[model samples]
Target: MSNFDIRDLLDHAAAAEPAQPAPASADEKEPRLSPLAERMAALPVRPTYSPVIITGAARLADIAVVLATGYAALAIYIAPNHGYPLSYLGLLPVFALATVAALQAAGLYHIGAMRSVLTQAFRVLASWSVIFLLALAALFFTKTSEEYSRVWLLGWYVSGLAGLFLVRLALGLAVTRLTRAGRLDRRTVIVGGGEAAERLIEALAAQRDTGVRICGFFDDRSDDRSPNVLAGYPKLGTVDDLVTFARRTQVDLIIFTLPITAEARILQMLRKLWVLPTDIRLAAHMSQLRLRPRAYSYIGSVPVLDVFDKPIADWDLVLKWLFDKLVGTILLVLLSPLLLLTALAVKLDSPGPVLFRQKRYGFNNELIEVFKFRSMYVDQSDATAARLVTKGDPRVTRVGRIIRKTSLDELPQLFNVVLKGNLSLVGPRPHALHAKAENRLYDKVVDGYFARHKVKPGITGWAQINGWRGETDTEEKIQRRVEHDLFYIENWSVLFDLVILLKTPLALLKSENAY
Candidate 1:
């Protein structure tokens, strides 16, 4: 106020401004949250290294193997009085290997089964016990009865069974603890903001061992249109932000809580998010769609309409794998002489290795090397499968034609099922990487074509027995095969697999469709 210079007086007046008026009131101000709370409120989130189906599957597999091996070893060691000094050590490894292999096939080592620890443990105990009894029966049949004492066998069985149970219990406890800590959970994000999203969140949170953890809601609306906070969760950003967040975060699931009536929006969202390696589900709880109850899966009694489900889920795949390896091994052993003759014939007829290896698309679009009995001449073997194998082709050797037409050439794939873990005994038959029908890719031709690959492709399948085998030159032929594949996937059971396996020999007799 006392400034003497004219310039100084003017500068003071210029620098002065009306105060910001203290931002009205706290309630009127926008909600400010702490970084951690902000993150939680804005969640439909995942951690960087979240657990997945493969990880859970592997853990269960390891647990089963460890229990099987450790129990056998411990039992042998504990029963010192009934066996020859060190000769029984060899039997321990053999039993462990056989029991583990059998258990794996028995569906005792599946990730879904692992969740029900008691049930899985009982299954493990039953499988190993049966295998042990079978070993005894084999010894008796071979008249090697006096080699081991009965006392040793009984003691071993008791100790091994107890040890198996204890190991499973410990594993179950550890898995539960980790799951509670959010280490072994599926991180989920809600795609809509409003009342429906709120209720879905509440329902999901109420379930114990449900395995879904909601991160946050994403909606493209202003504050008045979509509340800043809905059902205790904040509206993080927009649909664009959801895409960005999904990429940045460790999200494993995206649940669209929007109504199913928004078909165009749903399809658009799917097109945008489908390429991500996460699951995309459309919440159909609020919808009036009159769908089958089986079409809906529950989360603590809260119904969610399934847009997509896990393929080859639970213990079915485990048993299928087991049957393949077991039967494949037996066949390999029994048919050794025939295999030798085939090998000799192939070597004499063609200038190539006894087994011809070619790359084919396996489960999940993974490239796998398939084995054949060298049906094509060395110079003409197509590595990329650019051309289809037609009847009476020049590339086919004299013996090759006979073996291929007779379906004997595919016997080598039994080894693929056993050793490579690429093929199964019963399922959809795999097509070539460049396989086409009606001038379009097999995947492109069908709506959920790739979904058939949820389980491993088989050497012989339901389609093969139903006359859908061999060259799929016509659209009708391929469509029939795909239909059979889908039917198999939808109604898969161990008995269904067994029936297909039994019918395979009969199917092979009708090789009219074979190339």
Candidate 2:
């Protein structure tokens, strides 16, 4: 495994908030910063969480498709030429369908299956063999045996099995590389302190292939309850800090080292953190009570039971991301002329840059610069986004008005899709960094707000096309938008992404959400 360290980030954090150096005494006056110094001081903030779930999911799907197709194709090719038995070709499709059904039914396509490629390969082989045998039995019973050649059938079956094994052998290494690069990983946070958290960290470190990167930890008590460092990982903050961290850090799993006996406390903590988009698991190491073997998931030998799970994980995410980049790139290339014209128009109609980059909250509540065409006058632009663009706001330039209304101002964000790799072509729309609904942070208002970050924010999202875009000045608007975003996250796919993309042009024409 390649060495990875987050020390630079930590050092930057420490320097940014330079410790006051425990005062000579609580009585001595503290050094004061000048107004400029105060203004320049910035708090430690983690980058907005980036979505890996989709990427991981897509990769898994690709692997499954490759193995299934390769196996079926090999089987058809090697089936000893059954005397021009074109009827054997019919069996190919049947075998392929059966293989897919069996694979899905056996759960061999799941993200968790990546943990044990050998075990999973065996399951796939078993399932595929069963399906193939069933198909052969059906053919025989139907008196279709004359349509096949025994030699061809034997060759096909043998080759097909070989192909399955080969695909898995190749995939095992690829998946390991992806997971190690932090591409296919579960963001985890330690929930207990001292020895428990330390042991957990050491174990996770020992098995980097487990794909569980510690985002940090949250302990209720301060120095007394937790140590300054647990297995070289600091206490990022408190449980409250964990909530904020979950919002700001790219986290997916939260492992609670506290036993099941702390049921009341665990439940209370879950009530607070469970609302975020993360898998909450109770680390079952210290528990005297044992659950059924099937009831728990293990990292090496340490067992954990599920509490909450971030939805649309692994291969699902990978497929969605692939679709976004591929389709988004094609669209951008095709529409470059239109994008250029829009930029020229913005420049001629307004005394500002053609593109307006706004700080928006991205995955994990980290700030990202989202691109748009300048719609408002240079001086009147709202940096904090406290004021919503109105129907007749004088600050909006002539070009801004047209682009904003027609949704052309968003055209520049395609580069954002290609460049920063922040937004996708389809998914949930990312809101402003401080977007408020009902005078509360959107995260505070919406349960599992960060969950939406499980996938990339899109240029045109499921919510926007469904009439949930534009100025969210009212609580209902934000609530409805969140609802749609959540819905998209829960039921995501490449086909779904394609559907959203195809429908977006028509949705843009409607302009119900556009100001």
Query: Which candidate number would show the highest TM-score if scored against the true structure?
Result: 2
Q: Which of the numbered candidates is closest to the native, going by highest lDDT? A: 2
Off by over 4 Å in 1: 1-172, 176-183, 187-209, 213-254, 263-281, 284-303
Model 2 alpha-carbon drift over 4 Å, by segment: 1-84, 93-147, 150-187, 194-217, 223-236, 243-252, 261-264, 271-277, 285-295, 329-341, 418-420, 434-454, 462-468, 474-476, 491-514
lDDT of 1: 0.68
TM-score of 1: 0.57
Residue 163's C-alpha lDDT in candidate 1? 64
For candidate 1, lDDT tens digit of each residue in 1-515? 01122233224334322111122245531223323323433444323223344444554554455456545544565445544345565576676667667666866554345556788677877876887789889889989867766766776677666766665666566665565556656667788877788888888777675677665567765646466556655555666555545544465677888888888987776655543445677787787786888887765566776565545544654566678889878877887788888989999886769998878767655578888898888889887666777777798889988888788888888888889889987878878777777667776677556566656788888899998887777778888898898788778888888899889889888888776
lDDT of 2 by residue, 332-429 (tens): 89999999898888888767788888998666556789999888899998866766776788988888878888899888889888877888888778
Clashes of 1: 6
List TM-score per model, in order: 0.57, 0.67
